[model samples]
Target: MVRDRLSWMRFCGLGIADTVPDANTLWDFREALIKADALDALFNELDRAINQAGFIPRAGQIVDASLIAAPRQRNSD
Candidate 1:
């Protein structure tokens, strides 16, 4: 999804030509953070900051399904 979605790429600060990490790489990184016991701390900090900024989490989700035109894929032999 990160590679296919421009919004995700932008959120990750990646350019169109940048290589996105594979699933295993992401999983390993998360495991390392968990081993260091930092994941919960990170989430707590994020929650605190968002709350301080007046953001509330509600039950439900909103998706923007805007149509976008993309270039055709070309296969090279």
Candidate 2:
């Protein structure tokens, strides 16, 4: 019999196949992700376009960006 090399942890009847770190470590990771502002990414790109992108990247910028809701569309029609 070949044993699978993956480790499993149970969370509310669901199997999470990974090594278990401490709860405090998990909390720290959660905090880190919470602080990772994804909205800041677009602002950062716009900032670079205005400030650090020199000329080439600015010229190549997309003028139109359409915002689409993800959940309502689900897999997109």
Top of the candidates by lDDT: 1
Models 1 onward score TM values of: 0.64, 0.26
Computed on alpha carbons, the lDDT of every model, listed in order, comes to 0.93, 0.56
Q: Tell how far residue 31 is off in model 1, in angstroms.
A: 0.4
> For candidate 1, lDDT tens digit of each residue in 1-77?
89899999998999999999999999999999999999999989988988998999664888899999999999899
lDDT string for model 2 (3-22, tens) is 23233333223344444566
Sliding window of 10 residues with minimal summed lDDT for model 1: 55-64
Native-structure RMSD, model 1: 14.4
Those runs of model 2 whose alpha carbons end farther than 4 Å from true positions after fitting are 1-19, 38-77
